[model samples]
Target: MTQTVPTPAHLVRQRYRDPQPTEPAQWNEVLRVLHEHRSVRRYLADPVSDDTLRLLISAAQSAPTSSNLQVWSVVAVRDPRRKARLAALAGDQAHILQAPVLLVWTADFARLRQLADDHDAPLEGADYLESSYVGFIDAALAAQNAVVAAESLGLGTVYLGALRNHPENVAAELNLPAQVFAVFGLLVGHPDPAEDARVKPRLPQGAVLHHETYDLAVQRAHVAEYETRIAEFYAEQQLAHSWTERVLNRLGSVASLNGRHRLRASLENHGFRLK
Candidate 1:
């Protein structure tokens, strides 16, 4: 028997786990791909080709940049031994080792710094916190574009924020220079079919989409509603987790940061003045 294809309405419903899902006004393959995204934890050992990696980088470059500064770059790691060492530093996530390529995205000012040094330019603005934020934002936008591109090509990806857990170690492992910080890691490869990961539900539209003015007063109700919906989502996966509890636990204390709380010091060590 052939499997049934889900309608656009069904895909939208699956995204939010909505009991009363309505048909979207507009729908296309891009929308479908964006909505269907799920983090693949298990992957096949099949290697990603250099051509495909270049294509993904091209797609990433197409994403909008702030002021056209383009202060980001990526290091694609495929060496098994190097990946294993990185995996050890990054919370020992098996997926990091399993994936064919680990793309280490960086908030890089090194390129601009070189240009400035060569021309004797001041580059005082690069030392400010705002400039750092721009680099970080630009890197995130680029990586997200790569994620969409990879998924569109039937490849799987999962972001590894744990790369920041030991920033100094990861920087050393990647041989990154000063003014270049490893913002995060992205694993890319063919997904293992056995895992069969489902779409993780998100909060209700009203909870996040604030019209004109922000409505802090009504967010509590939205959270309550989302709790019940996501509880069922968790139960289906045999994972006894609460979204609220997870958030609190993940951000409740300095211990909870898992060593990322020292990120300011790490950034400073990496030559960001953060003035």
Candidate 2:
């Protein structure tokens, strides 16, 4: 038996939107699947089976967690009515309702807190700002693994960050208890061929990848180059907008957040002291 190795350069280029591409030194199905990822907004009506969902969660759980805390959980919403309500709360993303399943990944400490309470144990550490970061990071890592797993199985998935726009409503809809925050939603289903969502380009490697130390002096030039490269990508899709302009507008004002500006308040209301 023999195994093929993927070219590091090709992977790097795909991630960086480099105009000059090189042939991969080696290749395999896994690497191919990984590099081929794109967020799928439009989905076909085909259903994702229970077996596949289980496989996705298995892969998610397999991801590394800090201190073996495993402080993440996923709520799979299959009911159409419930999914619709969630979609409404989550910035009205239509695909969330269209997809067969919307997996709401959460940063969960409630389970551990319950266990600690059962034994009259103190979980003061879980209340710290550092611990909150751990929970969110752990959840993100696990969800990204599930995204890859879904893509490997020929399933399309998109992360709905907009779910946080109405975090309180989302939490209420999902019946999440205290210490369990809905990190984001992942919509999984068959991709609709008509949507024609292409691979969106990213910033050049020079902009993000720093050697041993960081350098801010070179950032302006890299961003300028990226503006041109990603422009072509957007043009192909018949969309018009400068990458910098989009990013700036998306975060330029608190209003652009579409209610996510209240995230800190929402988190506090959800029982995260953030102290």
- Model 2: per-residue Cα lDDT over 37-90, one tens digit each: 899999999999999999999999999999999999999999999998988887
* Clashing residue pairs for model 2: none
Which candidate has the top score in lDDT? 1
Tens digits of per-residue lDDT, candidate 1, 9-116, equal: 999999988999899999999999999999999999888999999999999999989999999999999999999999999888888888999999999999999999
lDDT for each candidate structure:
0.95, 0.89
TM-score of 1: 0.98
Question: What is the model-wide C-alpha lDDT for candidate 2?
Answer: 0.89
Q: What's each prediction's TM-score?
A: 0.98, 0.93
Candidate 2 regions exceeding 4 Å error are: 1-17
Least accurate 10 contiguous residues by lDDT in model 1: 232-241
